[model samples]
Target: MKMSKAAVLQEYQKPLQICEFPLNEELQPGEALARVEMAGICGTDVHLWKGELPIPVPVILGHESAGRIAKLGAGLERDWTGQALQEGDRVVWASSIVCGECYYCRIKRTPTRCLKRKAYGISYCSNEAPHLRGGYAEWILLRAGTSIFKLPDNLPFESIVGAGCALNTALHGVERIGLEMGDTVVIQGAGPVGLAALAVAIESGAAKTVVVGGPAHRLQMALEFGADAVVSLEEFPTAAVRLEEVRRHTGEFGADVVLECVGHPSAVPEGFELCRDGGKYLVLGQYANAGNVEFNPHVITKKQLTVMGSWAFEPRHVLGAIQFLARPRWRELFAKQVTHRFSLDQASEALDTVRRLEAGKAVILP
Candidate 1:
């Protein structure tokens, strides 16, 4: 057994413990070992820590990770040897493994929705040894069937880590929304995913892009990233008031597309109102346990509005996210989004910081 340092969650709504754990050295053919360099703390991680989402405890938590390929399993050595990968080559991995035989996979109807899906930091397959999974660790053992991509030589590790999970979600949401040139778009929430959606909307040629919701810094970042207008939700106590304010800034009608990046149930009804007649509403945020909201059915039927939902991204979205980050301007965006960085030992503190909305995005460097 090889020893590795990891931050393990011991209980719900509790601090994570930084402990030494035993890892299996025997890797299955096609597997690889990655020495983790950086892992971004996502809002979902905060949800899990707060017991808002049910992820198994005693688990090492981290999904947005980038690292270096340290060692390759037996048969993988030859294929990976000189192909942009080496003992210290930088890399980032797709977050989950899907069962290829599942019905969704067979029909090509969202493979990420496969019943046998296993997430790196959340769910573990039975065949995987405990230490072979998760990113909040000194070393992670990549199992077979995992999709690993080499990072561009010029890309900063923090940039890739910051863009990891959020960008993929943004890409998927934008694909679902199908934004067109000269379309008016409003993104709810100014967090990482919201800001990402805003960026993609602007890149998609949206004539006017508005970002609503805030903590000041995120709204500022949205403006920097090309948002035509930014609004702080704290000013409006009611959804109708917020919608009125949004309409005043936008045309008298409303936005052509509304993207909800705030997972709070309260935002769902407001998001629907932000979309104009014959517009689309995209829900990109992952809501916690059974939250309910009230919405007028007449608004959907009368306006001919399309309500869409997007979960984790597919492989194509992952590739698109990587390409989006390939642009030179992404360096500035990454630097702006990541406001806090903590060692793996301070995982709980980092998570708390995110929960309290203390930063735009917090990262954990192992």
Candidate 2:
């Protein structure tokens, strides 16, 4: 057994504990070991800690992770043996593991919905002992079937830590929405997910883009990222008014595409109203306990709007997001998006920082 320090979630609505735990020394076939260099605290982690989102307790909590391969297991070593994955080879991992035998996987429809799906920080497979999984730790044991990819040498660790989660989600949504060149887009919320969607929209050749959210700095960052206009929802009362304002800024009808990244139930109704006739609305946020938003069916019937929902991401999107991060212009985007960093020991504080919306994206470095 190898001893490692990890942040454990012993109870909901309580501070996470930094405790030492035992990890299996031997890696099974197809499994690999990594020494975590950095892990970003995501909004979902906050929901899990607040008890708003249901997750198995007494579990280690983290998914947005980046690290280096430390050791390779038996049979796998010969092919990947002596691969010289040094102390800092920089890498990121995909979050979910799907059961290939399930109905969804069999049909290749939605592999993410496989009956035996297990996420890194959310669900635990029987094979993984309680302490062996999760990313808020110094050492993490990657199970068999986990998709691991080498990080490009030129990319910064901070630029890709949360890319596996947030950026991948954005990429998935963008793909589903099928963004067209010269299309007008409106992004709701300036949080990590919203910001990511905005960046991808611009990179996809959006002719005009608008971002709606609160706090001056977040809006400022939206403008810096090529948003033609920004709306501070802190002063707005209803989605109708917000949509009206967005229409005035765009052509008086609405945007060709609307991305609801806020996850709040209210944003759903607002997003629907902001989408132009025949346009698409992509919901990328996760709203667990949020109350329902009332919308008229006539809106969709009359406008012929195409509404879609996107969750985490498939492996393909993860790969594309990593490649997107490797672009030369990525440095400028990172300069504004990554605003804070914390140590793994300060996991609770890091969660609080993201909860209060005090930073663009906060990462915990181990």
Q: Which stretches in model 1 have alpha-carbon errors above 4 Å?
A: 77-84, 125-128
Best by lDDT: 1
Which pairs of residues have clashing backbones in candidate 2? none
Tens-digit per-residue lDDT, 232-254, candidate 2 = 88766577778778888888889
Model 1 error, position 161 (Å):
1.4
Identify the runs in model 2 with alpha carbons over 4 angstroms from their true place.
Answer: 75-88, 125-130, 162-164, 287-289
- Can you give the lDDT of residue 19 in candidate 2? 83
Candidates in order have lDDT scores of: 0.81, 0.79
Task: Quote the positional error of residue 229 for candidate 2 in Å.
Answer: 1.1
35-65 per-residue lDDT for model 1 (tens digits): 9999888888877777786666677888888
Largest TM-score belongs to which candidate? 1
